[model samples]
Target: MELGVGWTLKPVGFEDEEDGQDAKKIVDNQFEKMDYHGTIMELGMFYRVLGRACQVNTYDLNGDFYFNKNEKVTGADSINPMTITDASLRKVMADRTGTEPYVQRVTGSVGNPGTVELEQDRVIYITNNPFAKYSTYGNSDLNNSVTDLRTLARFPHYRDALARLYSQMHRIVTIDSENSYNIIW
Candidate 1:
């Protein structure tokens, strides 16, 4: 299957001149015209965590969580747990030549807003209020007014994936002292 679009792999620090030369060749040969397929994958993680925040804000705006409210409210609710069967997150690995199956979804609230507990298998995709603004009310009043606004937390697996991607990017560009380097595959 087509694993989305390709990404440009830029070379960084290299100890050997030959490694730098190789990296330039690789860029010219493969990655020069590649596209990273938008930031959707990254946003996916953000969306899952902040979905509840959206719901909560919707409720505040519409009075009811389902309707559109007048106030600048923010929050979210459980809209059924997200599931990732086999082959959920498929993509071209950082090696730029291989494909890999990665975790797409995680159970439970990737982020939550309310202090009330959530149900099992029913994860809160969005839990924080990103729209919380300053009010003229006193600190205590402001605290109470904006008590619901919170930042969504990231999923552990998603966090891991981000870290791995960063590491891979860093690894691919490293140059050896011998001036010869192997492209990570």
Candidate 2:
């Protein structure tokens, strides 16, 4: 028998000057989700929650989410490959190196489109929209969405996910009897 698992890789870096010497620490990645995969009551439930966790964080971070691209993308570099983790989002880079102009500035001018400045940053994100509209109950949205999550996410209506969460969160839907789908904030 064999068991296989993949862990998230979080980037870490540091610099130090001690004892008349200069040194820097660079850890490419580390896993932060090891606990999420443990003690599952049901595989389906776990997968859905994991997917949601992925999606929620993406939006929370001002949609600054993406998958890995090059064999190596680092923060110290003037450039970063902030792709959509090849649609899996299993691997990501926030690009906090100030290399990107749009991402580095926190603009809040009067004529801007959105009133609130981006909390984190923005990216040309790609996702499978694993939370697309679907019947609740056992037929959670993950059912249809998972079939082609990558496809739907490639060019998502990012607002849809946020809208869905805002209107339907914790509110049980009666499927065909509901008109909440039209609501958006």
- The superposed Cα distance between candidate 1 and the true structure at residue 114, in angstroms, equals 34
Across 136-182, the per-residue lDDT of candidate 1 in tens digits comes to: 11122234323223221334445565556546654443434356765
Residue 158, candidate 2: C-alpha displacement in angstroms: 4.8
Stretches off by above 4 angstroms in model 2 are 1-141, 169-185
Q: Tens digit of lDDT per residue, candidate 2, span 1-185?
A: 01113233323353434422322112112111212222122232433433321111122244332223252222111211221122222222334453432222222456543322222233322222435432111233456455345654675766577557646655552322233344322
Candidate 2, residue 83: Cα displacement in angstroms equals 31
Superposed on all Cα atoms, model 1 deviates from the true structure by an RMSD in Å of: 21.6
How does model 1 fare in lDDT? 0.33
Runs of candidate 1 with Cα error greater than 4 angstroms are 1-15, 37-147, 150-185
